[model samples]
Target: MVVVGGGQAGLAAGYHLRRQGLDFAVLDADPAPGGSWQHMWDSLHLFSPPEHSSLPGRLMPVQPGETYPDAGHVVDYLSDYEKRYDLPVQHGTRVDAVRRDGDSLVVEADTGTWRARAVISATGRWSRPFLPAVPGRSVFTGRQLHTVNYRCPADFADQRVIVVGGGNSGAQIAADLALDGNVDVTWVTQRPPRFLADDIDGRALFDVANARRRALEDGRSDTGGVASLGDIVAVPPVRAARDAGLLYAKPMFARLTADGVRWVDGSQSGADAVIWCTGFRPALAHLVPLNLRGPRGHIPTDGTRALSEPRLHLLGYGDWTGPASATLIGVGRPARDAAREIAQLR
Candidate 1:
């Protein structure tokens, strides 16, 4: 068996695979164990507390003076978890393709091919940042960047900026910039931003998801989960920004102008830079040779196992793969199930 990626999802899969006593290697494109967490913006924090944001066997150690663990802390936790488990992960091995070879699958990577009875793809989405196509986007002369390129608020100090998208990244980055005071920030969203209740966090959200899943499994009326509450979670910085009236959002602009943007109401605002907090698409380019992608650019799966190919399992893309499987705490159950299923095949 082979698991592609060494992020939280991949590491979770590794833990379960170890318990199954399976022979496997986790191939990570990165040189280290932290995965995508190490690449996030400096101020980024988990939506939940450390205990609720941990991987399979070990709990993430809480950082002093932090209600929510920041990106650096999460990186440390992942690195520690990898070492604690002694999972066989091959760092810096970038898998280029997965192809069927007789009764097994061949994983072709920079480090050479590995033949395995089953392959689990847990690459996640951080590598492929999505930026929507707006009119006159190319003509805008100011600096434009996506969430992946943003590092810290100090980078945009004393400049008029536009933050696009209504998701967590949009709110967080806008709040981060708003706290700087020197940066003139304007948040633009497709619709009015929906902020979840202040008391709600990832733990509550996870419970709601589980409840909804149970309801569906029992053939009862579908009780909604996080989406029913709202879109953005009121993290500390975001709540602070909201309290300070710095998190107000404007309707999305109709098009980009030479210096800034033009709104649907014929209003315009000049800006020095535009930051796109738009989300990401799964990084599944390596699976192209498998010819498994559907019209929606997703490989159809039953639970984590690929629908078209039993030897392939897709993990951590989103709720479609498993309930909240993209999150640290939410991935364990699905990873365990996938590992169990693979073991049965053996």
Candidate 2:
């Protein structure tokens, strides 16, 4: 078997495959062990603790007195994890396509080809950031950047900036920008933001989401009192921003203008730049040869195994691949299941 991706999701799948003693290799396109995580903004940190954000078979080692691991910390952990497990990871190998060849599948990559009995595509979503099509977006005179390219708030000092999206990225970036009044920042959200209190953070929400998923899977009529964990968790920076009255979020404007954005009520705000944190779509172009993708570029799956192509499973894209499977903590379950099923065939 072959796993395409070396990030948390792929590592989780590798962990499970190793436990099953399956002959498999994880092919990562990255030059180093850390996948997309190495490319995230420097200040990004996990909302959950190290204990809740670990891959299967190992706990992410936490620094003394640290609650959350930053992006660099995670990269180090993943690097150490690959070494610790002795996982067969072929670095710098970019998979171009996965096509059917007789009873086996052919994994065509930049390095070489591998004919495997099954394939698991865990390319993840970070590589494909989603940017909404807004009118006059192209005509805006100001600089525009997606969250994928945003590094730090220090770059936009004294500039009028519009931070778009209601997720943690927007909130965190807004907080960073507002911390020292470095930038004049305006936050925009499609709806009112629901901030989870500090006491009830992402760890609790992850637990609830998993429990809810299990209940539904078992055909039990239990909701577990949580519909979604997509809201913002009140991390220290975000909390401070809220306390300082800098976390104000307004509804999204109707359209973009040449110099600014216009609201539905004829209101407009001039801005020097826009930071879009609107999230991402799954990166699954490599699986086009399998013809397993559906709406939203997702491969419909039964758990982690693709419904249309049973031999072609997808991991860590999102809930469509597996319940809460996009998160560092949530991916282990689905990865384990997918590996086990593939092992059974061997």
Candidate 3:
């Protein structure tokens, strides 16, 4: 077996695969095992709490009442976890193609070719940057950046900036720029995302877990703030932004103009820079025969199984409802389950 890409999801699968005693090697395009986590924007962190970010059998550094861990902590921990596990990982081995040649699965990479009976795809969903096609994008005079490329506001100080998207990134970045006391930030979002709270301090994690279960059992949607807050450490930053008077809600964007942008409300503004926090795209470009992908270009699998092909599985990347679909915490169950499945195959 061969595992591809070494992000959290990939590494989770590798960890379980290790315990399964499978003869497998993990390959990643990055120089190390931490793949996409190593490439995220600097000002980000796991929205989930630190304890939730742990892999199976490993605990992330946390003390009671310490607050949620940030991006640096998550990155540093994943880097260290890879070292302690000593996973047989080949860095800089960008998998170019994966196909089934008769009974054997073939993997072609920058390093060389390898064959296995099964393959685990753990490359993650955010591999491809998604940018919506807005009018005048090509004609923008100042600068345009995706949240994927945005690190800091160093260059946009004192400039008229219009940020697009209503995710946590867009909301928070606009608020940050506004708080910077130099840049004039205008936030234009098509729709505000529904935020959810996952934890609260001084409460039992199980209490919070029960509330979530009730919400799920009651068929609650992701569009509203959770009515029940148990294990969550704090309220969502979006709600906090409202409490702080940092948000200005508006209609969707119609398109962009050479001078700036025009919103659905027939309002026009001069934007020096446009930052798109519009979210990510899942690209399984290297998959053989492109087994199954949904209409939106995500791998459409049966969720937890991870096997898009009989002996071929895809990890990390988002799929239908199962343990391995989206959140960092969602990876372990599916990764380990998939590992067990792959072990049986071997």
Candidate 4:
């Protein structure tokens, strides 16, 4: 078997597969072991506490006095997790395609090909960021950046910036930019943003979601107002922004102008730049040749196993793939299930 990614989801799957004593290799496109966390902003921290953000089998080693870990810390943890398990992860190997060859799957990559009995595509969406198409986007003269490219807010000082999207990324980036008093920031969301209570962090939300999922799995109806991962986790920066009255979000703009945005109510605002905190689509273009993708290019799965292609499994693309599978803490269950299913099939 071959696992086509080395992110949190891929690593989780690798752990399960290794424990099951399966002959599998994890293929990662990155040059190093840190996966996407290495590319995040300098100060990006996990919304959940360290205890809640750990991968399967191994607890994340805590720092001397820290409860939450930053992106760099996560990178180190993932790197160490791979080394600790001695998981066969081929870093710097970008999978170009996955096609069927008789009963086996042929994994093509820039490095080399691997013919495996089954394949698990755990590649998350970080590589495929999504930006909404507003009118006059092409004519907009100012710089436009997605959350993937955005780093520190220091670069946008004294500039009129609009941060779009209602998810955690949007709120976090908007808050980060607003903290810099020099930058004038406006947030745009399709709907009113919902910030989880100060006490309710990612851990609580993950627990609620897992409970609901288990209830449903056991044929029970869940009548709970469970929170989605997108709900703001009241991280320090976001909480500070809320207290500072900087957590205001407006309806999305109708279109873009040369210098700024044009609102739906015929109102206009001048802006120097637009920081699109918009989310990402699943990076499954490599699987398109298999013709298993459905509408919205999402591969329908039954508990991580592809519906159309049983030999193919997809983990951690988002809720469609599995409940909270996009998250570090939430990915373990589905990955374990996928690995178990693969082992059973073999």
Give one digit per residue, the lDDT tens place, for model 4 in 9-108: 9999999999888999999999998888999987688878788898999888785566778998999999999999999999999999999889988999
Q: Between the candidate structures 2 and 3, which one is better when assessed by TM-score?
A: 2
Root-mean-square deviation (CA) per prediction: 0.9, 1.6, 4.2, 1.6
Check candidate 3 and list the clashing pairs: 121-315, 198-232, 199-231, 199-232, 199-233, 200-231, 200-232, 200-233
Q: Clashes in model 2: which pairs? A: none
Query: TM-scores of all models?
Result: 0.98, 0.96, 0.84, 0.96
Leading candidate by TM-score:
1
**2 or 4, which is superior by lDDT?**
4
**How many angstroms is residue 185 displaced in model 1 relative to the true structure, after the best TM-score fit?**
0.5
Off by over 4 Å in 3: 63-66, 197-240, 288-291, 304-308, 319-321
lDDT per residue (tens digit) for residues 1-346 in model 3? 8888887877788899989988888888888555666666555555556777687768888734546666667778888788888878888889998888888889889999999988887776666778888776887787888877777666687898888877667776776666666888877777544444434432243334445545665799532222343212333554455566665656666777887877777888788888887887665788846466556675556544433567767666643434323456657777887888878875
In order of listing, the candidates' clash counts read 0, 0, 8, 0
lDDT of 1 by residue, 38-127 (tens): 999988999899999999999999899998999999999999999999999999999999999998999999999999999999999999
Poorest 10 consecutive residues by lDDT, candidate 1: 293-302
Q: Evaluate residue 81 in candidate 2 and report its C-alpha lDDT on the 0 to 100 scale.
A: 93
- State each model's CA lDDT, in order: 0.94, 0.87, 0.69, 0.89
Q: Which is the leading candidate under lDDT?
A: 1
User: For candidate 3, what is the lDDT?
Assistant: 0.69
